[model samples]
Target: MTADIAADILVIGAGIAGASLAAELAPHARVVLIEAEDMPGYHSTGRSAAFWHETLGGPLVQPLTRASYPVLEAGGFLKPRASLEVAEINGLPLLDKLASEFAGTGVGLARLDHDGIRQWVPRARPILVGGMLESTGADIDVAGLHGSVLAAFRRAGGMLETGRRIDRVERIDGVWHVQAGDWHTSAPIIVNAAGAWADGLAAMAGAKPLGIQPMRRTIAQVRVTTDDVPDHLPLVIDIAGSYYFRPEGPNRLWLCPHDETPVEAGDAAPEEIDVAIAIDRFETVTDWKVAAVERKWAGLRSFAPDRLPVYGFDPVVDGFFWFAGQGGIGIQTAPAAAMLGAALLLGQPMPDAVAAIDPAPYAPDRFVALAQR
Candidate 1:
């Protein structure tokens, strides 16, 4: 078929990362966003737990999450939903340490005694001795966010191609020639935002591999035989990372064992053992009986060796950008991350939203030094 397509900036994924960045840059550049899947966000973006909490992704990611809050708030994609971190007697000290560490970070976490913890999460078993509440946490509308971003990109004259899986990439006379299926695309700049397949995409572009590992996370929706399940239930997580759950709806709960099994990039599915583990853990956390496993699914969260998102152009490959390794926090940090990525790609100053964040920690050059050692 050999259809020739050209763009000033060719983004190699249509997930949240690619869509957000394309939306940010489409107004200024000729952008083309391509997806291997039949539709955008068929992986992690669609399978996300769909919560936006300031402290969910750790201290390094908090800044990006905070920067993105305004956009999400303005877009009406955020709905108020608090998060509770419950701890057993042995885990109480860890909760205190976490509260102390985040003291002045603007992610206020209030220490909750046993009574307060129960008040927040009434269904929690008596094993919980203490807890902390992130009052600013909220549920994010993932689909809405992704759709809005892609719609804006298209409105700004960006081209979107689905079912085009890039198999070959080569730089020819200052232009990147990318071949996907029967279609061909050429651009001066190529953005690698292929999520779990990021390293593979970079390798295809002749860029250094960043050792991005895709880890599988499982989640299941179970109907609980309990009268306490409420639509307003806060997201309850164990301080020790054992399990987490929140009300999917009245009499229903969404739960995960907080598993991070290392795996390759592809369409992820929930393992039966993992599902059983999640249910088993949930039983220990709450007295609610699981009536049935309504549904279960799994998704991949890719991380760099340092477990931080990588952004900026490849230090060794000209016009090739690194915008992967966002892990589980990509959706919450999309607005700020995309802004920063587009700014760097365009050789512009950092946007005010993420100006305070230092880009050095996420630069691809960090791996270059590591690889040399």
Candidate 2:
């Protein structure tokens, strides 16, 4: 709104990543957030069954998750729910590797023997040899967190454009022109935060695609035969990544077969076969019967080739910024990621929250470098 310092930035994708960064940069710039969906966060953000665990996104993303805890916790968007990864006798070595993988990363991982894990999962099948517990893990309130960021963007005088899929994007006369339909906007910079559709969005801008692939993950909310399903059932995952389940409520649980099927970018629906697979995997672990499947849904988790988030300006595109490929941990790591992103994009020093993290590993140029080699 300043004539002396004219600025305009268009962020494409009003999900957690774009919303949070747009909010962060709004006070310093004129920010417009564009969403293809009618409502913001309607796609991947609303569908996430996410949790805050240092171990979830693997070692490379742990720092962001750890640093983001203060912000998420201060906002009261997390609940205490531990995550336990159990292994059968043959899978104990995998469990040990999990323990050693994060040996000194400051993430707390307590090795659990059969009896130790039994205390957390009393009805676990007896084939288990041991497990590891991430006591610091907690359930992330995805909706609350996404809404909060969107609210922050609005409060900071940022604009939100919805229901507009990008029909055309071109950089002309040193300005980028983007249009969803009859409406369009031009700015010096454009940020691609389009979640599952990121690679497609990049192509629209004449930017090289980073191989951001969308993979479908399925979930089923099932009613159990057991009369009293404890509210404290921790999120239990298989060491081999075969399946996972946790209580959605008393007598109701969300079961997943840990299936990550490759798919094209779009709205994802849970397949009936996947639901059956989840139930079959669930039965293999416990005596609790799934009395009924109350609900089922699927969401896309997009990832770069290396599975790390892409968070820098394109090495080739003049004004296109890459902020996609966050996978399933985007919500949990939003605060720190936004901090790092806004700082990098604005040419400012990173805030104390993310200063310890080096930004080179996540740069979009890494892919180009790989291609050159």
Candidate 3:
């Protein structure tokens, strides 16, 4: 199985991040995308309950999400879908605080009273008194977007090698020698976009590990007794972050308990306890009796200490790039993030799509100062 391969840039992890970055850089450079799994997006990217919410990743990530909207919309990967954040009467103050946080961010939030809450979600309990609607929220076609990016990269002459579990990396002279099983490759630059396993990849490349921690989140599809479930129902969430649900079909709904449990990087599976907790929380939110659980799964969301994405070259490791720690914002921010990463990798000006935002906050050098201190 010994073979030799070479590329101008070698990217590890063929998830949304690697695929999108390859597509962005292919026209200008020879890129090779490597994935451990037989298929791309076998983990986080495939399991995402793909939705583009303006406020999902908080203030720090809003810019990248907003910057990516134009590309996502133009690709026909986004479908109109609003989001509703609900709170109990006593929780109105918290809802108000949330609304004020996004005031001038261009993420429009309209406050809703009791009647308004009922109008948005007929199944909402009477005790729910306050809500906020993010009209710009939309459903993302995750598979479509990932496939399209990979397709474009291939069409542009970017090479892809799946089932290549990279085990060793070494910098010899000015080039990188990467080995996965019996195969070998050499490139001038190595991009770590390994999702939950990003830290391990960095360590393999003799780069500083950014302390990326993968947290498990559970989602389930269940049949509810409520007959009013509509296909157009906005994504309903609790401002308290306890639970969220939206109609999936005639009588089925996609629900989650909003759980984030710290776990090791691996193939994640759903815990029955988490699924039961989700069902219990959903029952308390409304009168919808969960008739049965049809499906359940779990995925990991990796984060840096600051909860922001890491996207720059390692200050100490020459030719090594950091494109990890995106967390749940990875999917929504892929397009813009790739463009930004590509721009930085090539030492070119920031693309117009993300020119307003400074890249310093996400640079690997930020961690250098912190590590020194």
The reply for model 3, stretches above 4 Å from the true place, is: 1-3
lDDT of 3 by residue, 1-373 (tens): 2229878999999999999999999999999999999999998999999899989878878999999999999999999999999998777888888877888888899999878877778777877788999988999999999999999999999999999998889988889999988889999899999989998998988887989999999999999876778777899998888889988989899889999899999999999999999999888878788998999999989999889999999999999999999988999999999999999999999988899988888998898888789
CA-lDDT, candidates in order = 0.91, 0.89, 0.91
**Model 2 segments beyond 4 Å from truth?**
1-7
Better of 2 and 3 by lDDT: 3
Give the lDDT of residue 337 in candidate 1. 95
RMSD of each: 1.5, 2.4, 1.6
Q: Write the per-residue lDDT of candidate 1 for residues 20-62, one digit (tens) a residue.
A: 9999999999999989999999988999987898887778888
Find the 10 residues in a row with the least total lDDT in model 1: 1-10
Give candidate 3's TM-score. Answer: 0.97
Question: How many residue pairs of model 1 clash at the backbone?
Answer: 0
Q: Which stretches of candidate 1 lie over 4 Å from their true place?
A: 1-3, 371-373
Residue 42 lDDT, candidate 2, scale 0-100:
75
Ranking by lDDT: 1, 3, 2
